[model samples]
Target: MNLIKQYVKEYKNTYIQSVLLAVLGVVSGLAAYIVLAKMIVGLIGKNTEFGFYLQYGLMVLAAMVLKEIFAAASTSISHQATFYSLKKIRQEISKKLFRMPLGNVMNISSGKLKNIIVDQVDSMETILAHIIPEMTANIIGPILLLIYMFILDWRLAIVSLIPLVIGMFCMKSVMASYGKKYQQSVEINQKMNNAVVEYIGGIEVIKMFNQSETSYQKYSEAVHENAAFYYHWMKETMIGVSAYRKISPMSLLTILPLGVYFYLNGSLTIVTFITIIVLSFGTVENILTATNYMDDLSRIGTITKEIGLILDAPDLEHGKENVSLSGSDIELKNVDFSYSEDKKVLEGVSLTIGENQVTAFVGPSGGGKSTITKLIAGFWNADAGEVIIGGKNIKEIPLEQLSETISYVSQDNYLFDMSVRENIRIGKPSASDKEVEEMAKLSGCDEFIRGLSAGYDTIVGEGGGHLSGGEKQRISIARAMLKNAPIVILDEATSYMDT
Candidate 1:
């Protein structure tokens, strides 16, 4: 609720306006109910004038129109606020991801992050846009209408509340383990999503190894588990849910019998009795409508908690100081680091490479060669000691300065789904078309790119899927070359390239 309130606070004025309009709409609806009840009474008494009855009918029509207009206005405002808030949240999440440690970000699976950023965030739309304003109106409108009923006849108002209390008692049973149940359901769904994404991502590997059956079996198992969880949860709660649904709307059961008793015994006038009955019916109907949204309301806490986790993820330490570099000399002094607690990759390592010199680290795989380069480029900080460039500890350098000084291209370079020209221009966003072509030719990819149907303008599929491995490598090389940073770290950068 605090999470939701924080977002609502961002668009406070618009949100308040939406709630106010919704209240007005509810008032208009209740006014129409009152006019209709009076018209019914006038017809029954046989002492009302024809013009008076016609005036009441017209007033009812006017009230109905006002209700719709205000309701639409409220919906429109709330939706605008909700969508904007979602956009802001997504942007913040994106920015936060960049600041967070790469290890921390990777700790969460792609499927889970996708669910949080896209699906879970999207689910809040209905609650914010419709449920918040509409449910508030529905609940408050009934309380106000019930107060009017009490003024008409206090005893009948008290009688009208019996069904509501019974319905709430049943609803409490459904709500008892609702949070736990909902959390379990969400976990199962996330696992299913993860399996689906993993299967699709590894489809080529599965097909190549003929492991489709085993892989598909895992996916099927996940789907079945999710389905079974929901099935059992719903089965368990069905009785309580059904009881609430059946009992909440039966307002007239208590009202009809008790109002008749009061009237027959000369304790209640016919006009007042009929008015109480009609108004009480409207009150319970509003409450029932509001009750229908309880499931969505209950899930808000869980959803916001998930989103909060991402927004609050720990970030890597970054400094504000910007240093001027005289040369691209790189040094590592007593650096010790590990990817995990027990597995130390590098320990007490010391090395130095002079400016304008090429150095190679030749060793067997998993021997900290890539790790050494990544530390120097500030991809990850060493656990102890310092990696220095230009005589200053890399930790003290601003991220922007570090990025500008070093161009690190890894083996698995990612390419966006965009034109060949646009992909290369990512290294230097302001590079002109001629400059892009120059870099592509320098990296030896220009001939192949020209052979394609659209040359540099051709759209590279996701991760350069449409291009060959060597072509992708050349494009990556071209992008790095375009960056023109003083220091370049090529970790297995030439593994896919042909001589």
Candidate 2:
């Protein structure tokens, strides 16, 4: 909740206004109940004047109309503030991703990240836009109404709270281990999400290998496990939930019987007793609405903690200042790295590549060829030793400067869903159309690109899916080539290209 406050603090004034309006709406609703009691008391007292009935009836209508107007305004304002805060949170997460180590970010499941960024952050909308303002009104309104009831008759006021107290016990039981249970729900849901993503992403391979049944079974099992967990969880909590819902709003049960007893004993006046009955109904309605949000409120900790894992992650260390390079030579001194503790991918490895040289690291599959290039490109820091570029340790160079100094093309290069011109221009954002065309020709992408439906302006679908593997590789090459960096590292970059 404190973390969420930090994000929403910028819109504090707007939220305050929303809360104030919501409170006014609650007050108006209470006013309607008071007006109804007054009318009933007048009719019972033998005041059968038509003008009096019409006056109180119009007042009740006006009160209800004002309540709706204030509620609408409050909701509108809160939603605006909430959406702004959500935008800021997402933007911060995006910056956090950029600053984090590539390896660390890649290690996280894509489905989990999507769930946090898209789904989990979206969940905050209810808490911010509706819960905060309206819940505050619900609570404060009941408190204010209770004060009025106590003033009318202290005995009935206390009696009115009996149902509420019992309802609270039921509510407490349901919320006892809510945090732990909600976390388990999140984990189970993530497994289903991951399974669905993997199944769809590998649909092509599944068809090619005739493994649809096996893959589908895995996906189906994950979904069933998630459903089963929720069903059992609801089964366990339903009794407590039902008891709270049934008992909480039954304030009339206690108020009616006790008020009548007091009235029969001449301890309570008829008008006061009747008024207390009407106000009890209003107070109970407000309390029940507020209590209904407890489940959403309880889940806040888990939601924020999930998002916090990404926002609070340590970024990769790099020097802030750019450095002057003596030359383009690269060197690694006794470097080592491993994706996990149990496996050592690179150990005591040393290498040097001279300037203006076409160096090739020839090795069998899984020999750390791609890992070695990634280290030079600053994708991950070497576990044990220093990587040097141009007579300077790579750590001394700022990330921006290091990025500008290297041009890397990997086996699985990604392309945005945009035109060929825009995708190639990403290598050099300010590159003119002619320069892009020239780079395409230099990288051997010109002939095929010109033959496309829209030439260089052709739209490349997501991940360049519209292009063949060979065409995708050539376009990637053109992008890297446009950077015109001193260092170029190609790790199976041409694997998809024609022989």
Task: Tell me the whole-model lDDT of each prediction, alpha carbons only.
Answer: 0.89, 0.92
TM-scores for every candidate against the unseen true structure: 0.95, 0.94
Residue ranges of candidate 2 with Cα displaced over 4 Å? none
So what's the TM-score on candidate 1? 0.95
Model 2 lDDT-worst window of ten: 1-10
Q: Write model 1 residue lDDT over 1-499, tens digit each, in one string.
A: 6767888998989988999999999989999889989988998888568898889989999999999999999999999999999998899999888767666787888878988999889989988998988999998898899888988999989888888899899989789788888878778888999999999989999999999999999999999999899899889889998888888777789888988988999999999988887887778777888888888888888898889888877766667878777688999999999999999999999999998779999999999999999889887888998999988888788878888998888888788999999999989999999999999999999999999989989999988889888889889999999999999889898898877
Pairs that collide, model 2:
none
Model 2 CA RMSD to the hidden true structure, in angstroms? 2.0
lDDT of 2 by residue, 1-499 (tens): 7768896687889999999999999999999999999999998899979999999999999999999999999999999999989998999999888778888899779889988999889999999998989999999999999999999999899989899999989879889988889999988888899999999989989999999999999999999999999999999999998998899888889988888888899998999988998999999999998888888899999999999989999877778898999999999999999998999999999989999999999898999999999889988888899899999898888889999999989899789999999999999999999999999999999999999999999999988989999999998899999999999989898799976
Model 1 scores what on Cα lDDT?
Answer: 0.89
lDDT of 2 at 256: 88
State each candidate's clash count. Answer: 0, 0
